[model samples]
Target: MPIAALSDLAGKAECPLLVIKVGSALLVGKEGVRREWLTGLVAEIAEARARGQQVIVVSSGAIALGAATLGLDKGGRGSLADAQACAAVGQIALSGLWAELLGSHGFTAAQMLLTLEDLEDRRRYLNVTATLTRLLDAGAVPVINENDSVATQEIRFGDNDRLAARVAQAAQASAVLLLSDIDGLYDRHPKEPGARMIPVVEGVTAEVKAMASADSNSGMGSGGMISKLQAAEIAELAGICLVIGNGQHDRPVARVTGEGIGTLFLPCRKASARKAWLGGRLRLKGSLVVDAGAAAALERGSSLLAKGITEVEGVFERGDPVAIVDGAGQVLAHGLSEYDAAECAAITGMHSSEQAAVLGYAPRSAVVHRDQMVLK
Candidate 1:
């Protein structure tokens, strides 16, 4: 189907929940918080909530506001610690603005800052989902942002675009609206005369990829068109439709929700909840190397058998997450290990049928069950 048609269908349907990601560029201008733009966005969100549709906002503006407030040079001359400190100062002001705007509409806004580690652990992921679900049920809008104040390079979400996609996957959102400075994804940078908007993208193909330009010259923020495309791919894999459009447009959320603007990316395939969690949520703690035949079997959707194991690296408990690597040292996939590191080492190269004898107790036939495996 054409993307416009799909967007029309989505807008007309009674979508239960919507995830909107507002970029920093739209939130902060040369002066300060773009009150006019923010006011419109809040109004739209309020309208949506009044219609009984839940909304979760993944917003980016802390660093920009921090830069402005501290009178520091934008996007330069700041160490990681400096930026973290700036975020710490700006977060308070940012939340205050949201609270005031939401308050006028007879609604309340709650702040939620997350790091990569929060979603990497299974228990934490479940807890986050439950909390957000409860907030939505209570008619409260959750304003989410990356925990930049304490986040290090190792545990950051990298960019708000990807973070928004992950949030949509965790919340099981119906669609993700990525509001940016640009109108939509185009054949090239929109500044060029010949650049044309590609309204519908069936998939992220090589041809579509070649059309992308690495022209993220924005000094105020890190994300650009490339990051937005990556977020679309992530959301598509998780069976959620994604739309990228200009946040500066009047009534941005309402316009997109009404099928009047932006580029729409259709979902390719729907992944199961367990598989999606296994694929995107878990952080790898160790790796298991396998031979070519074993890699082939895994690619064919088979489970990891002990006979195919070659070696293990790193220390991980039985329920810990591990990476499946090929003999050449390329990561094939990730899964929760069924045995401890020592047990897996002892049973390497043994037949799966003999697992019970080698370990003195068999847990399951496969080392990594098919249901627990996600192909990378």
Candidate 2:
């Protein structure tokens, strides 16, 4: 069957790494864990593995499982302590189920619990990325989740939708599947009389974002359409494709990929080696704002010169990832800064020939060399 959306990228060779996000409501309910659904999902994952596809799962439902098992009263808004307790208790059961299901298919399931801070901190981010890379290399499925048990508002993502996007970026996944309750994004609420599902989104525009609803049908899941769109934007920025589809169908994973029964958010474009490296950076040290002329030059694939820089924000060492914004505050690109922040400050607006007189050094003509930059 022809892919429903993103037909250009339907082939197996196009997607080497696939990250799938499973919503909580589909996995847990008042009746408890959904065994039949889990079984089908695991079979789909196994089939992908047999085809040499690398898969990672970012799953939800720990709190719902914990709440049900502990018999917690859920009649009103729950306290942080209650949520934390539920997550702690529920994570065990959730991980166990994944392990058992995958093990039955003769594949190992490794659990990875992470908080927002883990990804924000450069060191911690690299460490986690290394661990995930090792696990995937060993032919193990890394089942990841937000560390909800200890994640407070200060360090919490509030939902796994955005977290899954981050995981996809870190793992360098080509495609991500968001298995939600709904089949795809609609022009209006799906239940409304004249709602229409948008099959393909080449880009996330203001009009497209307006189509999403903030409310979710599942009380067990934290993310709604708004968060999923935010995740899609994130994935798009990182040059990764994302599909949002319903998890209720049989072989949902396979169908979404092969038949395209979902809304596919295409990336801006395929990333070159340098662009991919720059786009995947989780931590950026600073930013350099340039004039419109410089922005235009960069867009035309020209090198950035010191004379083009208008201002610098934040302290950054040489070789750190830095944002390159235009005069209107639009992010034009991201690249490695050739000079330190202090040097950049001293040399801003100076001609290339004048750099030696100002700093007694001119490492290169460009503040951010063309070879190191990725235009957004």
Best by TM-score: 1
The CA-based lDDT of model 2 is what? 0.84
Model 1 clashing-pair count: 0
What lDDT is obtained when candidate 1 is compared to the true structure?
0.79
Residue-level lDDT tens digits of model 1 in 161-277:
888888888898877888887777899888889999888777666577677765654557777777777777667767787888778787887666565567888876677876676
The ten-residue window of minimal lDDT in model 1 covers: 1-10
lDDT (10s digit) by residue, model 2, range 5-69: 54433355777688899999889766899989889999988887887778999999898889887
TM-score of candidate 2 on Cα atoms, chains taken together: 0.78
Worst 10 residues of 2 by lDDT: 1-10
Error of model 1, residue 246, in angstroms: 1.9
For each candidate in the order shown, give its overall lDDT on alpha carbons: 0.79, 0.84
Could you tell me how far off, in angstroms, the CA of residue 50 lies in candidate 2 after the best superposition?
A: 4.8
Reference-based TM-score, model 1: 0.85
